[model samples]
Target: MIVVIDTSSLLSLVRYYLPFDKKGVLFEVIKSKVSSGEIILLDAVYEESKFVGQKIILQKLDFLTDKGFLKENKVITKTDELIPLAPTRFLNMVKNQFVANPFQLKKLNESEFEVQKNRFMESADAKLIMYCQHLIKDNPEEEIYLVTEETPSANDLKLFKKIPAICGILGIPVITLPQLLEKYPEVDLGFS
Candidate 1:
């Protein structure tokens, strides 16, 4: 039961807005799971946490890194380690293929222009997807749940499917924050 957290869920918990908090009911549940060594976070997840509105999550990175919780494991054990899988290259290949298709690239560019403008363009989405690909590639067995707040539009949906597609190709499971939360309530998830 390796639970990989995304940035948004981490922010919610740190801000005490979501069910998982230092002392929230769900927090207790997740904390136990983490303590028992079930929940884990990817290194990129830390990158996302740095932008959380609250200071608590940002401040705890050092402690969490030291404790081998928020940070990825340096040593590759049979079960644990950061960047545990290697799906990055695979993801890049697919993304490259998508971008190479003039129709798809034009659609993505138009969508980016109409929506994100500058905040989050196709490049950013590609980067995120590439990162996910990296995760799937490196840690083939670990199940990952992307904890993002961004909802997918019809176009975005097609693009986002690359994650699950990659996971499917690699025989890995990819889910969302709430889905993981609901399924793994008994798991612990908090920093000491």
Candidate 2:
């Protein structure tokens, strides 16, 4: 199983678990899985988390990278294979599910649409989706899942695209950090 984690989920894991165990038992389990190539930590998510400037988050991510537990998404350059664009159907879904919502676009002028679109394009969610698509394309036989803290919003007023929703549109399976932990119940934290 190749589980691609997003930034929010990573932060949630760090904030919730690190205080309980300074050695980061849960993180260590995740790290070990990543080292074995069962897990994937996208470079975009890493960069986004580092941008948070939280010492603990930075330290944990640093430890994972330093120990070769985290695998960065393959870099796509112009000379390399051209990066695939998000499917038109997925873009349409984003338009209908997110952008077209009156509440989400409320008080925004026509000119702001471009700004909003640009913001989404540059967002970590967008980057994560791209990486997920790449992984799916490169590894068809592998079961790929996206790990994100984001839940699909019942409220149509959300200004930004949530990770799970985007994953759904892309036909990618999505799970939360807790759900992921449930899969590895045998991992003994030895919590004193």
Candidate 3:
């Protein structure tokens, strides 16, 4: 199974007050997944984590990032075959979803809409959906799942353009990080 992880899930390791030592355990599990060819980390997601205000989160993430970890782990980036406009095309198709999102993109003017749309265009979320779609087309036999911490929107009033919502529209199977841990029972979080 190729679990294409978003920044939400990765930062979630540090975000949810999982305690310092436990976060390390989870990070190690993530590292094992990456080493075993289970997780596909995107460069865009790593770059997008600039807004993480917590120093501890940054430090832990940096540890995974140091020593060419992503490179050595073969973290996937936007492929050359992945045209720059492809993700934008997707954003355009889902423009209504954004306009409905009162929390984030709803109050924008035309120019502001353009800028916000460009932000989504350049986001890891865009590449993630596109890549999942690409995989579905090119490798239907492969099991593709997205691991994100975002909950699937319960109503249109919420931010319906989040990764989970978009994944739902694109027919990509989605699972939460906790569900992933359940699925992989071998990872023993050794705390008594």
Clashes of each: 24, 0, 0
Candidate 2 regions with alpha-carbon error over 4 angstroms: 22-25, 64-90, 154-158, 190-192
- The TM-scores, one per candidate, come to 0.49, 0.74, 0.75
Question: Model 1 Cα displacement at 31 (Å)?
Answer: 2.7
lDDT of residue 63 for candidate 3: 49
Model 1 stretches astray by more than 4 angstroms: 15-23, 54-56, 59-92, 96-172, 185-192
Lowest summed-lDDT stretch of 10 residues in model 3? Answer: 76-85
Q: Write the per-residue lDDT of candidate 2 for residues 1-192, one digit (tens) a residue.
A: 778777778788778765665556676776677666677665566667667646556676555545332224232111123233656655565556645356667677867866886667566677667777877888899878788888876454557657776677678788998778778875555653
Residue 15's C-alpha lDDT in candidate 3? 64
> Candidate 3's residue-wise lDDT over 80-180, tens digit each?
35533355666666676544465565466778777766666666777777777876677778888888888765554533367777777667899988778
Looking at model 1, report the run of 10 residues with the lowest lDDT sum. Answer: 75-84
Q: Cα lDDT for residue 115, model 1?
A: 59
Top candidate (lDDT): 3
- lDDT for each of the candidates? 0.48, 0.66, 0.67
